[model samples]
Target: MRSIFYIFFFCLGFIGYSQELNCSLVVNAQQTGNENQSIFKTLEKQLTEFINNSKWTSRSVAPQERIDCSMVITITDYSGENFQGTIQVQSSRPVFGSTFNTPVYNFNDRDFSFRYLEFQNLIFNPTQYESNLVSVLAFHVYMVLGLDADTFAKQGGDAYFKQAQTIVNYSQQENYKGWKLEDGLQSRFALIDNLLSPTFSAYREVMYSYHRLGLDVMSENAKRGKEEIASSLKLFEAMNSRRPNSFLLRTFFDAKSDEIEQIFSDGPNVNIASVKETLQSVAPMHSGKWANIKF
Candidate 1:
């Protein structure tokens, strides 16, 4: 009897670590002006459970190996079961041989709208359109997985990004704002489109170089790591020359600007003359942050 109990508990512990994402989801309804807050609270709890408990990948992951991510859904208006809002999704992965986690992806999706009842089951269907809420959440979950995977290997995120693309394909036919080509440049459609296009291939290279060759090696050899990271920044120049002021470029900097500043600010001295120029040109919006990169 004791052996049977020990085996059951061991299986439970093992299953707990197999899920891929450790996501914190916050559903903010302050702007809605709805006095009854219980529904929002219930939505947050259910969505949190849905995202964190669902197995996102086929690969087994230990607790420490799960990708750390977040979603902030700000409800701008609500009427009946309809919700209109924006969702900010961000994710990060741990640096090798260190306690630090480097931010990998940050994106604000502004065209979010959905319908939900308090106790409706949030199930994700990859092959078909279920609900905009489930589709959007699942889409970002795969995106976070893909982006985190890219940081570890060259083009390692292909499969996951393809998964996100599939979600886009499935959701476009629905009467949603962010899932079609005409839905503006920053839509979920545009994001997945740009990621899969061959024209933006260099972006993935930069991701691999900046994380694997650069930040991951910093603990043991800060100078070499800094140089690798600096070199990675130059890859963006060619990308910028082709498509200047791209959504992908802004997305990269959104997650990395502060980290880039801190990295070059206090590091073993390396020539960043050209890289600094590249930064000013490719991501001018982050000019203020770049101004502080002393090296």
Candidate 2:
């Protein structure tokens, strides 16, 4: 929590053209590897370079405004050129007037399996089908950009989400596993589908309020900022009540539960019990955290 300082001072010293995503990547192959373990090392280097060096969006993002994200790929099984594993994708954005970087997306996806040849260049084409590896990485890249854009402006991520939709549409012609409607409710299809759906418009509004109005204002006005966040939770409660359990809501609480607890620990003079009740009603799975939120 202490590291959540504003970067106002830090940003003053840096200026340059930077890519949209500053993604720190890791490929863990200790658990699963075929006869030749050397391929994993090459895989790590190529993937790292691929993600950091690729220009995801056409818009030129300034150096300081680039998104901060991490990708961890853990191999559970490997044979020949076929690698099986999970990928953890997470991203954060800086809060206004504060040094804190708020978590926008954090997910551990087990629905990934791709084949990689040693020293093969990773490539992505938007208009055609690519390998599952490139498609998956590209999908999350848009998601990160989209979610980050939503915080700053209302439905500002439409272009990025539309890009992801294009990837999903193109992947349907391939034999991939994560891009279909029949892939179940929590599939990647459902995530972007729900976001782009008209039914979930309120969630986008809550995102803007929670980040731009709520957390961003904390350093300058803690009480009002906290109130805005608390009010947005009421909006969350209403949405959850209307739709019941949504993948977006679950994803929201997943990324935000701990931060919500930390922000309200002892700073606000508002009704903590009311806030607790609202949270518990919407996210009962996090009862353990809300249970400790008194006063």
Candidate 3:
């Protein structure tokens, strides 16, 4: 009877663990001189709105689960050509009587040298600072979700990235030029593709770097395991072939062309389907060129 009870409890715990919800976001606030209080309040309001409007998944965690998250925007003493501050965001859903916090990301000790453009103003010039902001925020949110942007990029998770890129893309459409505040808020989807593309690009670079770094590490240690080393080299070559101009790829391949050559001696087998799938993931499904790309 005791064994049966333990088994039942174990299954319950496992189910609970698997059912935990995941939420993510990035918060940006300005730190003007002597207006910290007002700025903070505005940021809090914005943060609240941002959370409420986001599409959080696995809503079963809490009956009232509505994008449960918190954000901290601190204005630093440093100031100059760019506004300096820190953004700390924690996104989570209640699990087992405790909130499972997403990874705490610290965009601290940084500087922002851009125009104080309202989230709505970007609709006029989508390729400007707003696009950059969207991309940065997307990367932050993905990291917080415990999803390595680099790995996901290579594994063809572009749709996840595209959701982020849509924010930028939508902002550029002419129809929303005179959009209202509420409509502007909803238009964030436009920038999703712009935001996520850079992330995937960066991920490709990092993976290539890691492969080269691994090879160098193994050169000193022959018993470093062949299977693992071969796998890294294979992935590196594959990613490099896809994005040859990537900084990490250029650096890695340039430094160890011989090793990489040997690894892919059998030639490369391009995965066109995977690439298409990845592109579709980050491409805005609702508008623009994305509409032409069939899923």
Candidate 4:
């Protein structure tokens, strides 16, 4: 009975500590023109381990249920401890009853700048700003978490977004470019601010309706799914009417334009004339992809 008790406790402990993200990170320093590649390699390895191993939330996420995400950090300039570059973060979630993974969040942060020493420990402390490196990463991670959760349920990501907001609050005192409002409309501050704002609530609603109500039901009913997807896209009409080509709308299409195009071009055809119009109005930059949706 002692052995059985030990096994039970061990299993419980494993479940309790299950990490939330299956993230892959790549560090590119080719622009630095440094012959010594060891520093970049170490940065990649350490940051990869830091992000994948760290538990970002209290939820018990199984290994298979972990969110799939990737980050590409390109170093444009590197000297001593100071590194300046851009990071492209993307995340995807698996569609229900399908072998496909749908893109969730795709963002490029041009203001990524930080200091790091080789083998330096990377830790995330939510209450205070540890470093721009850690704060930037943790903020994006929460954004991915929040957006992914939004796909599964209506406003289910509020808690995660709130955590990201806390990081923003803590990091604003630093010299980071992305954390300040004056950085630009496309800055990280704008992204999170737009997400949490009541002005863009339709963005969250469309996220839930498009993925959970639309894509998740595709395998079961392709026609119904396509119809629901079109209906969900209509939610953006009201948003676009007020904001007219907002950053949040652009962000949504950045991750979903291809999928949206493919969904309407193939499978069962539904009345998408209005959705296509809304897409062109809100996400005109993706007009090329939208134009290809011949259905």
TM-score of each: 0.96, 0.91, 0.33, 0.97
Model 3, 33-117: lDDT tens per residue?
A: 5554444454445444544443323223332433333445455543332334554544432222223322212222132222233
Please tell me which predicted candidate would have the highest lDDT against the true structure.
4
Q: Model 4 over residues 1-295: C-alpha lDDT tens digits?
A: 9999999999988877789899989998888898367989999999999899999988988788999999999999988899999999999999999999999999999999999999998989978889999999999999999999999989999999999999988898877898888889999889999999999899999999999999999999999998888888889889889999899988889899999999999988787787788778778899999899888
Candidate 1 clashes between residue pairs 3 or more apart in a chain or in different chains: none
Better candidate by TM-score, 3 or 4: 4
Q: For model 1, what is the C-alpha lDDT against the true structure?
A: 0.91
Question: Against the true structure, whose TM-score is highest?
Answer: 4
- Stretches of candidate 2 above 4 Å error? 1-17, 33-36
Q: What local lDDT score does residue 136 receive in model 3, on the 0 to 100 scale?
A: 35
The CA lDDT of each predicted structure is 0.91, 0.86, 0.37, 0.92
Give the total clashing residue pairs for model 4.
0
Question: On residues 21-138, what C-alpha lDDT tens digit does candidate 2 reach at each position?
Answer: 8899988877863524678778888998999888787776678788999999999898778888899999999988767888999877778888888998788897787788999999
lDDT of 2: 0.86
* Candidate number that wins on lDDT, 2 or 4: 4
True-structure lDDT of candidate 3: 0.37
What is candidate 2's CA lDDT for residue 185? Answer: 79
